[model samples]
Target: MRFSISSDRLKEALSKVSAVVPSKTTLPILQDILFELKGNALYLTATDLEISVRMTIEPVDGEEDGAGAIPEDKLTSVVKALPEGLLLKFESLDSNRVLITTNKGGEYKMSIEPADSFPAIPESIGETAGFGVVISGGVLKEIIENTVFATSKEELRPATMGVLFQFKGDEFIAVATDGYRLVKIARRGVVNLKGGADFSGVIVPAKTLQIIAKSIEDEETCEIMINEKHIQFSTERITIISRLIDEKYPNYESVIPYENNKELVVERDLFLSTVKRVSIFANSTTNQIKFKLDPSGFVEVSAEDVDFGGSAKERLDCAYNSEPMEIAFNAKFITDILGHIDSEKVLFKFGSPTRAAIVQPYEDSEDREMLMLVMPMRLNA
Candidate 1:
């Protein structure tokens, strides 16, 4: 089999698909990328079993329809050295060797496994059904950045590794948390799919979604096709497929307390900045920070490390509507959740000192559709 394509176009396509190649591959074939050449288009594919991304590029000229697997690392290295606009040709001169010669007067021959030896990808698409969800690339990135940080890094609870995508009426919500803090964002006017595995509450691994989100950053809208076990994101030139986390996500609704007796409205930036500053003195093991609020409309933030004489306290004017209350929370959880709150003013809803506290945007307007829940820490005070 022999095929020739422009090095520039080939490299661009390979750059996108090669992300799926594993950094530490168990199987040698998993480290290579499958290249398929058709009449005028070239298909590039990479997979680590958990996720697969495929991209297509059209060459300036189509030589022969052929397919092969090339060592991704070596192939990328070789292509990067070739001059722009130079043509690179791939021909199976031997069963185990492929020759790559460029128009730029450089020659390189590399040993490679045959394309036929590559493991089979689920290319059939399995009678999949898709949704016509339309979300701006900016919106998608914003939600991911705000919530993905809260996803648990530990693998013991698989559901915590993913962001939950749920559809309710006209609202499309994406939520993620690591048990200490939770973020829920609702995007109205996003399409809700039917006729397929409507992946509601389906935990999509945060890592996989981040990769797919980056691939389609330039497109205004993207389609998500879902089957029983896999989810696919299709762009005009790229397709990313990822396995779904089968475990059931925790009932997040229950975790969010509705009747929090205390409420404080504060400047978002000031509150977040204070948390960052006070957290520096928090105990290393617990990272516990305290908030003292009174009906007087001001709050004192403080933290202390008894072992080292570390303590900090700050005061800020706030809008308090209920009786005085004090609460203790993990500084990291507070900072992590605060980073995602995008509003000039934010509302802190609190109940008893031991109960969870809810943080939300100041107003119920549709502009900022997010609600965060932060579990409080057991405190001595």
Candidate 2:
């Protein structure tokens, strides 16, 4: 079997799916990319059992139709090493190896595995059990970017390690939390549910969304098909399929405090920079930063490290309408929340020094609403 494809095109398709390839796994075949020629297109697939990505590349020329599994790293390295736009000829040396020769006389051989040995990607959610929605690539990108960082890294609570996608009526909500902090973004009229149906919140692993964020471009809309067990996202050239987390996500609404009466409006950049600087003096273990709001329209941010005898404090101008209050929070958590805000000013609503606070973008978008929560730490008495 033989075919010809451009070096650049091959590299691009390979790079997109390369993230799914396991660097070291007991399953050696999972390290290879299944390459198959169907008509004028070459199909490439890579997976690590839980998530799989398959991409199609249109070839420049072909002599025969065949399929084989090429070691991803070897194939990617060789193609990338060649000059871009160079046409490369591929010929099967048998079922176990492939010979790759560049049009300019460069050559390399890679060991191949029978394509059949690659594990089968899960079939799309069955029509009877699954439903589908269409959302823009840009919206999906923003949703993942805003929420992924808040997912829990510890495996003890598997549900919090993924982002929750809740679809109901004409609204879609994406949420992620690590117990200490939570980020939630909701969009209206973004989801077109199949058969006018609704889905309870579904937990999708953060790793899967990370791959989608990289693979999906600025296409107008991507179709998302989901069911109780599996979910798939598809565009023109790429499709991603992964198993949904089976555990139930926590009822996040119940924990969101309803009595946040104190509101503080401050410049986002100024507050972020102050937190960044004061955090340097915070205890490395606690990363605690204190917020002191006074009736004089002044807010003080401070941190102290008793172990190293280091401390820092700074006061900034703000619009404080609520009563005087002081609160303690993890500096890193506050900084991260502020980083995701796109507005010039941020509104922080606090219930008390001991209750969780809500942060919102002061200037709003017409279509989307974002809310963030950070738990307060105990103040040093």
Candidate 3:
């Protein structure tokens, strides 16, 4: 088959789905993108077995319909380097070679493989009808941004390596935890698809959500479908199908402390900067940073590395209403929580230095809520 499309447009579509293609796969064909020309549209698909993304783009000019697998790196490199707005010609030649020619007389050829070599996109399990939910892209992006950072990288506990999506009534919560830090984002008044209200929970890999977040545009709404094993996200330009983590997420709510009576409100930027600066001197092994909350609205932050004879300290004014207290925390953990807060000010609720502390945005929104919990470290001093 032969087809012609804009180089820039083709590059953009390929980039969107290319993240699913593993750089090095046991099956060499997995490194190539499956391309097919059907009717007036050109379809592109990429997969790593566990996750697949397919995109359809209509060609500006075309001839016969055809399908083949083109080396992803070759196609992406040539298209991206070509001058924008140039029409690119793709034609299948003898001996499984595909010729890519530019409008300016530039030509390139690469070997292709049968499109059938690509694995088929998975379908929902038999006897199980799928359920779906309709949510705005912006809202979905917010949920991922708030929680994905806390997902565990450990492979042994596969559940903790993904973000948990739990649906209850009209609200849905997204939770992620790496054992040391937990992030939960709750959104209310979401529209549930037909037969979707009864759906309980699903764990989505953090990598999948990260790709979805990058592909979606603001103000766009996407349809999310979940079955027993596979979850799908469909938007205007692309559709992503990924296997669910297939593991039960921990009962994260139980771990949150209820007796965080002490509250300290501090400027988010100031606190974040202080933690980052002080962390440079923290022991590389423990990353321990000390926080001394004063009743006079000042917080003393200090860190020391006995091994390297390095030390750092800073004091910042804060709004503290609770009793005087001192807490020790991993400096990296403190900065991570502070970085995710969008508000100008953040509130920290603490019951004791040994208990998990909750961090929240000082300003509350009606439709959404975000809470982060960080486990403290033991002070060396």
Instruction: Note the clash tally of each candidate.
Output: 0, 0, 0
Residue-wise C-alpha lDDT for candidate 3, range 1-381, written one tens digit per residue? 789988888988988978888988789999999988987798889989988988879745768888999999988888878888898899899648999888899999999998777788753332353677788898899888889999999999999999999776668789999999999898997788764466678999999999999888778888888888888888777788888998988999899986787889999999999999999999998999999999898999999999999999999999888888889999888988898899999999998889999999999789888899999887676
Cα RMSDs, all models: 3.1, 1.5, 1.7
lDDT of each candidate versus the true structure:
0.81, 0.89, 0.87
lDDT of model 3, residue 228: 82
Candidate 3 Cα lDDT to native: 0.87
**Cα lDDT of model 2 by residue, 84-190, tens digit:** 78988989998898999998888898899987898988545547446788889998998999999999999999999999998877778999999999998998776
lDDT of 1 by residue, 98-149 (tens): 8887877677888777787888887635377444355566667777787788
Model 2's alpha-carbon lDDT is 0.89
Candidate number that wins on lDDT, 1 or 3: 3
The window of 10 residues in a row where model 1 has the poorest summed lDDT is: 190-199
The TM-scores, one per candidate, come to: 0.87, 0.96, 0.96
Candidate 1 at residue 373, lDDT?
93
Deviation from native of the Cα of residue 235 in model 1, angstroms: 1.2
TM-score (C-alpha) between model 3 and the true structure? 0.96
